[model samples]
Target: MRVVMFGYQTWGHRTLQALLDSEHEVVLVVTHPRSDHAYEKIWSDSVADLAEKHGVPVLLRNRPGGVELLGALRDAEPDIIVANNWRTWLPSEIFDLPPHGTLNIHDSLLPTYAGFSPLIWALINGEPEVGVTAHRMDAELDMGDVLLQRSVAVGPHDTATDLFHRTVDLIGPLVTESLDLIASGRAVWTPQDRSRSSFFHKRALEDSRIDWTWPAEDLERFVRAQSDPYPNAFTHHRGERIRILSAAVSEGRYGGTPGRIFIREGEGIVIVTGAGARSGRLPGLVIKRVRTEDGTEHAATDYFRTMGGYLTPRP
Candidate 1:
């Protein structure tokens, strides 16, 4: 099959590599320009560079659907369009151009998480598993008919980075398998259940700010979700920003106001947490490690020498 690939970053890079390795020919590649956003910088393997190295035609665009881009796609005459981590919403003319239409590879099990930073969100919400979905693109964003879907179990202590590594491995095999099915006319596209669907917005630095009102378990998962290479979950202590590097739920339940620097338990410093903290039944968040603004990491016990202060949402 003659393929046109729309992708960006490592996800796109992986998808393009899969296409290149497969029997199909990648005629044209469309990818986003480099981004300065913190999250975008991580896992950023260059899709454009890989395409150029292989002598495939490449177009750099912040968004798709320009007249020149449209002309390029038409000239390339792709039998199918395969997209992964394409940042912008593709118009129908672009996605529906080829005979087989567009196949999008997303990082989550669709009809649930159908938007940006899915792994992080899923980990934070304590989903049982996280995976990738290969589906046919239609009018709605990520609300496409499924071609192939694969998932990995989210372990109790798994971080977002762990989930990323596991699920990314699925991209190559999933892309190739889905394409083979489509080319041979054995593809079974399943319609997404809109009733079970959910969409999320792009993550920003502010989204990592710690909200102590959440229960300790939720906060612990939140920290793991925003693990290193992404962004650390953070809080403000004594007018200084501190990122939570490692944390756990305290074994004992002792609470006052949320975010209060309470007592030490084992190797961590317990911070009173949850809206119902005053009842002293909810477990506090035991902060094990923290990073200062200057990039210095420290044990939470050493950082909080004297307790009884509050960790605020802002300094």
Candidate 2:
């Protein structure tokens, strides 16, 4: 089958590589334009460069249906278009252009965690499982029939960067399997239950803010979800800001005070939260690593010490 692939970032790069290495012919590749340093620099290579290396034509279109982009896509005349986390929406014409219609590879299971930053959102919600789905594209965003789906456990120690990389690695061979099934016309697609569907927006700094009032377990999940590649969960420490990188539910708990910094045990500092103490259990977290707003990374305990002795002093 002749394939045209579209995506950006690490997810897109993996899909492009997979199709190129597969049995199908990739006629052209489409990706978002390099907006600026912020978006472009995160990725080591653009999808265009990879396509060029494989001698497959490449198209960078900020708007998938804009005049030039639409023309280029139509000219490529691919049998299938694989949407691997393509950020923008495609017009009906483009989605319907290819012979086998468009199939999208979403990071999350459809009808749930359907929008952007799915792995981040899953961790933020403290979900035990994270997975991907291949679906048939529709007019609505992520409102498509599911072709195939698989999930992996989100370990207690997992971070957004960890899950993001795992998902990208899974997408490579996993997608090739989907293509093989589709190529053989043995694809069994499933319709998503809209009743269980929820979409999320791209996370912003506001969303990453850690609420002191939230239970320590909730805060811990939030911290882990946003840490590292996804943007660290933040809080104001003695009027100066700090980002929480690695945290986990600690064993000890006293009373119901949230965000009260307790003694550091081993490699972390314990704090309280509701999610941490569910089912009549004492809930809290110990932060391991912390980064200050002033561009310094430090052990959480040491940073607490450097913060004008605020960790002690008693609130």
Candidate 3:
């Protein structure tokens, strides 16, 4: 099959690589230019570079569709269009251009976690498993018909960075297998259950702020979700910003206002949490490690030398 790939970052890089290694012909590639956004910078393997290395035609577009882009797609005459981690919505003319339409590979198990930073969001929400889904592109965001899905278990101690490495590896194989099925006319597209669908916005610096009103277990998961290589979950203490590098739920419940830097527990410092914390039945967040505004990491014990303050949402 003659293929046109639309992708950006490591996800797209892997998709294109798989297509290159397969019997299919990758005629054209479209990808986004480099971004300075916090999340966009990570897992950024260049789709354009890989396409160029293979001598395949490459087009860089922030959003798909322009007269030139359409003309190029027509000229390339792809049998199918395969996209992964494309930053923007693709117009029908672009996704529906080829005979087989578009095969979109997403990082999460669709009908849930359907938008940006899916792995991070899933971790924060404590989803038991995280995986990749290969589906046919439709008008809505990740609301496509399912082709194939492959998942990996999300361990209790797993971080978003860890989940990323696990799921990104699934792209190449999923793309390859999905394409083979489509090419051979064995593909059975399954319509997604829109009732079970969810859409999330792109992550920003503000989204990583710690909200003490959440349960300690949830806060712990939030810390793991925003683990290193992505932005760390953060809070403000003594008018200074501090990033949580490691945390856990406390062994005992504490009674205090949410965000209060209370007692020390085991190896971490316990911060009172949850809206119901005053009832003294809620476990506090045990902050094990943190990074100060100066980027110096410290044990939470050392960082909060004398606890008795609040970790605010802002300065």
**Which candidate ranks first by lDDT, i.e. highest?**
1
Model 1, span 160-243: residue lDDT tens: 999999999999999999999999999998999989999999999889999999999999999999988888999999899999
Cα shift from native, residue 166, model 1 (Å): 0.5
Better of 2 and 3 by lDDT: 3
lDDT winner, 1 or 3:
1
Would you list the rank order by lDDT, best first?
1, 3, 2
Among all windows of 10 consecutive residues in model 3, the one with the lowest summed lDDT is 57-66
In Å, residue 57's CA in model 3 sits off its true spot by 1.2
| lDDT (Cα, tens digit) per residue for candidate 3, span 1-315 | 999999999999999999999999999999999999888898899999999999998999998868999999999999999999999999999889899999999999998999999999999999999999999998998998999999999999999989999999999899999999999999999999989898999999899999999999999999999988999999999889899999999999999899999999999999999999999999999999999988899999998899798999999
Residues 32-95, model 2: lDDT tens digits: 8776533244644578888888888887777776688878887888888998868888878888
Report residue 125 deviation for candidate 1 (angstroms): 0.6
As for candidate 3, its clashing pairs are: none
